[model samples]
Target: MKDAWIPYATRAVPRYTSYPTAADFTPETGVAAAMAWSAATRADEAISAYLHIPFCDKLCWYCGCATSVPNGYRRVAEYVGLLLKEVSLRGRAMGPHGGIGHLHFGGGSPNILNPNDFLELMDALQRHFGLRTGAEIAVELDPRTMKPGQVPTFARAGVNRVSLGVQTLAEDVQHAINRIQPRDMVVALIEDLRGAGIDAVNMDLMYGLPYQTTQHVVEAARFAAEMGAARVSVFGYAHVPWFAKHQRAIDENALAGLHERFTQARVAAMTLEGAGYVAIGLDHYARADDTLAIAAREGRLHRNFQGYTDDPCETLIGMGATAISQFREGFSQNLKDRKAWGEAVTAGHLPAERGIALTPDDRLRARALETLMCRLEVDAAEICAEMDVPDDRLDGALDAARELERVGLCHVSGTVVTVPEEARIMLRTVAQCFDARSPAAAPQRHAKAV
Candidate 1:
């Protein structure tokens, strides 16, 4: 890594997964906004739904997800009931849509539910939302907590894709993060899922762990390839103890330094690319034939709260606590507190507690940011024209990009701004230039750009 880039890489920046970001959400735009947005969905357009299961058997120290350990099944069962009711309410609020084209189950771990309970939830989703024929159902799983018969049950329920949380293979690093699934365990789970006919496997690998080395990161990427993972996401472990209390259990001193973290990221990227996985966006790698790779190749890729996806649904309805829903109007989040979320749903209301209404400018900037983040380049003039706004509306952003250009972070040619291949890792910094709502100075509020 160049010393000149260190200052840029170390600075905090929005991931730009969503323009205006979650930082802009507030109580002023709550349930009413969410209700209106859902009600306003065009009947002819297919939509996406996200179900968040915020319960896990074990809390990994390095996890930043909104999940907790349920000492007993009663809590999970109770939560599932509320989740189903919430689904019904949201479905009714949405009125009639083309049907659900994409369904996603995420969490602390969706596998935490009992197999029967999991199937019931899936049934409820289909019953209420009218799951479109041949729609994609994707779920995130923790191999450590995967019970017997779960794989078969998931296949029976029509789950087509499974993302496994296989953050690291090193025993020392796993122990440090309080997640100790062996490499063999993960490999066996993958084989079992494939045997049951759910072959679209996505493995998640991490780089900046408490005791992770560049070799550890590289070996993990290699293992994912060897397992025939359809996609692999290499993420830098964010150490935000204040945001995720469980992360405080990790020793900060044991984490890799900035340069080491940068090297580990590069090594993992090289390993995945060398293994024939096409790099998709910032941190995702996919086999050349995978849908995500195809999306990137054809420019159909999209970024959402769930990271990169090929789902083209315009409306993403998020169910359960802390899940964020994206609509044409803006973004809405269910209450983060489980009790509050349950109460709202029990009262026959949407659980949305805070959100932001997207202004025309917000939409325009979002399009430009999404374009740059997904394609590594954006034609500002084209975006403005597409948004039916004058090209001068983006002059401020283009000027900002010009400043970054002088630093070798990006190139500004006419109304087009492109992040160079070498500066791809700093993509967020370049995208941040177009964010009108970003705070001037609050490094602690976001993860470093790298």
Candidate 2:
């Protein structure tokens, strides 16, 4: 019904979930910076935590997450052991923080670990940082690999939310992506999680996969609402075979074109918003009463490694291989190699391998990008005035906005830039206007924005 609005929203750009996106992270900045930032968390300040479980039971062709298929439980178990050790190591480095207000488990599939291992992991985390009284503990699950008793493991670990990766319910599409699961199976898993007291369920849906169409995307959106998903994230499939090797398995010829991808995303937005879900950012939607909805309505929504979130804690301590931690001053990322990470932790050193220290310019651009991403508008003059930045310093970004405005994607007043409501899908392109990285450096670096 809203087909006329599709053509204007498909431009590709960085999600701006972070300024100087992950593509900008390099080896020049290392563990020392991360440790210092972690140690800097005031004893009375609560922090957010993220743990990466990079092992998956099966590899989906469309997945771009940092994960690999472990041949057996031994590899995963080994990773878990190292994760726990890093947990303790980072805990020591953090000294005494107030407590963790938000704890998130993400990856290839967090549910792949055995129930007991999962519980012990949570216990180890609590012992280290100490969890806040009403903190939010969230995990991303692969319903296809979920075990019978794992739901209880999540509930017992005090997980208040579970995000199930149900990319699509169409059998053929699932088969094409190598992540098949019947619709009934997903519904059952939702019911099971709810019965186990994990009432907050977020379902991940996608379009532009091999053989996907706007019709399929709409169908999936309606089904998600029918299943009572509190939140649904509709992501346009980003095809980057050279980067994500498994993606090569996806037939490029069958993948939807950029315009079609745009329609699919728009269809999802229209369907979910029609179903009473509030669109929170470029890709996430939540029910009216959801915390994300509250965050958006109150202008408290935040963008993070996990995309749109409600967590306001400034320090984000990341654990496990290749995990990235954020602090007020900078970011630190753990080594991607399991053996190397474990060895570093065993040696009583943080396993961080690379990072970036945020410069004042980086911070300013970051705030500007976040404002545009979350609120769809930015008062450049006002923000610069508040930050004591010279107005002329943003001339380059203004020039970029002029180019976008010529195309009718955004409007620029004397000191403000506002992305039109219908052009929100192109918000990333607008956000990229402030990126300080060279074009050659970032173009080859990230997935297409569509």
Candidate 3:
């Protein structure tokens, strides 16, 4: 990595999974806004739903997800009941949408739910939201903690996609991260999921972890390819112990330095590409025949809270503690505290704790940012025209891009801004130029751009 790029790589920027990112959410625009937005959905449009399961059998030290070890099943069962009630409440609040076109189960670990409870939750989702025919049901799994019958149960429940948390294959790296699943364990689980007819497996790999090397990253990526993973996401470990408490367990001194982290990311990319996977976006690689790759090729790809997706629904309803929902009006998040979330649902209220209402400017900037992040380039004039805003409305952002251009981070050709292939890893930084809500310098609040 060039020394000139170090400053940009170390800067923090919103991932732009959503414009006016979660940092802009507040209590002033909470449940009432979420309800209004839900009620305003077009009846003819299909919607998507996300159910979060915030419990894990064991907490991994490096994990940043909102999850805890519920030593007993009691808390898990209670949460599931509350989640179902919340789902019903949200269903009644929504406009007469066509149906749920995509249903995603994410978590600390969605597989934490008892097999029967998981089934019941699925039934409730279908009953209340009307799961559209051929809807894709996707779940994120922790292969280390997945219960014996869970894979078969998921298959029986019509789950078409399963994402496994296989962060690394190196035993030492796994030990450093406090997640010690062997490569063979993940391989066996992949086989089990495929044998049960759920073949769309996505693997999550990590680089820049405590004591991780470029070779470790390469080996992990190769393992994903060998396991026939449809998609592989190589994420750089964000050491934010102050934010994610459990992350404090990680020894900061053992972590890869900035340049090492950058190299690891590049090595992972090369390894996945060498294994016949097409790079979809900054961090995701998909098999040449995978839907995600196809989506990217055709410009139908989308970035959401779940990272990258092919789902094109205009509305996304999120349920469970700390889950975030996206609507045309704005974004809403369920209460992060379990008790508060449960109480709200029990009281027949949407659990939205904080959110942001989108302004016309917010929408315009959001589209430009998404275009740049997803496509690695954006025609500023074209985006402004599509949003029905005057081209000059984005003059400030274009000016910001000019600075990046001078640094060789991106190119600004009139109203078009493009990140060169060499600067793809810094794509978030380029996208940040258009983020009006982000402060000029707020590195403490977000992960490094690299």
Candidate 4:
């Protein structure tokens, strides 16, 4: 499977993080829909939030996030001020619902904010949407920029989990990607975070990077294990220069080919498993005792825009420029332009620019796709029954899977499609079969399956 899969490896597919993915969002559904949906949060539901900090001190060429290098702190301060207003606006729009169960700070680097600024934002979130008792607060950290005092400050604000961006440990690979952080920098930061009561340390590692080899991938995975990382996410670097222009800075010639990338992903998974970590879903590996691993084992695992998660919240308030919000009705995204986002927030309006309202068909297919992506298998018949649709509703997808099975992509036992372990890297390829959004017609919109 490893050597024979190269032809399909480079074929692009949506991450299936969301059904109808972001590519299907349209301007037809804008702020009014956002407002109506936001106000409809279930009274008994415990919601989640994603606060996007679109500022980073430095730009990493390999990064493909909605962020920029703010030359000065002035822009960041202004962004945060508006973000707080947006939070209040969102909270009020979502009147009288259960409190927050999961709060995530993601960005170019969420830790780019000063300690005081971080605290101020936390306070605003608490005031607006109270964090339910033991609610998970997770932050994505940049080890090189993390200050000594920020660790404890994060803990003080109830940040119990952190994910350090440790893409590669090899000096050459680090130089190639332009995200330089010594291994010791990450080690020290982890130790400090642990000392500050932030014990759920998740390390994000990457394969398929420029100048990266299987050895480089293995060393990073091993380092995550040695440093006691509770969760390690091994991501395949997606080089989408057309989408993320900074990627043009990387030397495309130096990037690993599909075969080599497949090898690196395999090696990284093997190394993490060798260290007693359980592979959760496609790329995440967690200690056997970690909540994420336990969730995967107990069938409580879920996938979101943030990848594999234990978060079961139905409503996610996305606050910031280019942030995408999730609700039972559908999805909405804040304005991608900072000036536009700020103006909307300042005018006391929902900042939603574009989105897609979920159709019943979309939701049914979404459940099937997420189930397959999370568990590597899905009984389409069972899903259709659960969604109150006909068992034959997904006959087209089963036929698609049959075509893939001829090429060894999946096994279709009646309506149950199963992706073999060897096909895990191409999980999206199998999952995309259920995507009703015409994924194959928009190949360049997403990354390669590998």
Model 1 CA deviation exceeding 4 Å by range: 439-441
Give a tens-digit lDDT track for model 3, residues 16-122: 78889998889998988988999998878999999999999988898988899996999999999999899899999998899999999998899999999999989
Against the true structure, what is every candidate's RMSD? 1.0, 2.2, 1.0, 1.0
Q: What is the TM-score of each candidate against the true structure?
A: 0.98, 0.96, 0.98, 0.98
- Per-residue lDDT, model 2, residue 442, is 43
Candidate 2 vs candidate 3, lDDT winner: 3
* Residue-wise C-alpha lDDT for candidate 2, range 288-343, written one tens digit per residue: 99999999999998898889988888899989888889899888888988789889
Instruction: For model 1, state the Cα shift of residue 359 in Å.
Output: 0.4
Point out the worst 10-residue segment of candidate 1 by lDDT: 439-448
lDDT of each: 0.91, 0.85, 0.90, 0.91
How many Å off is the CA of 397 in candidate 2? 1.3
Model 4: residues with Cα > 4 Å off, grouped in runs:
1-4
Per-residue error (Å), model 2, residue 264: 0.6
- Evaluation by lDDT, superior candidate among 2 and 4: 4
Measured with C-alpha atoms, the lDDT of residue 372 in candidate 4 is 94
In candidate 3, position 81 carries an lDDT of 91
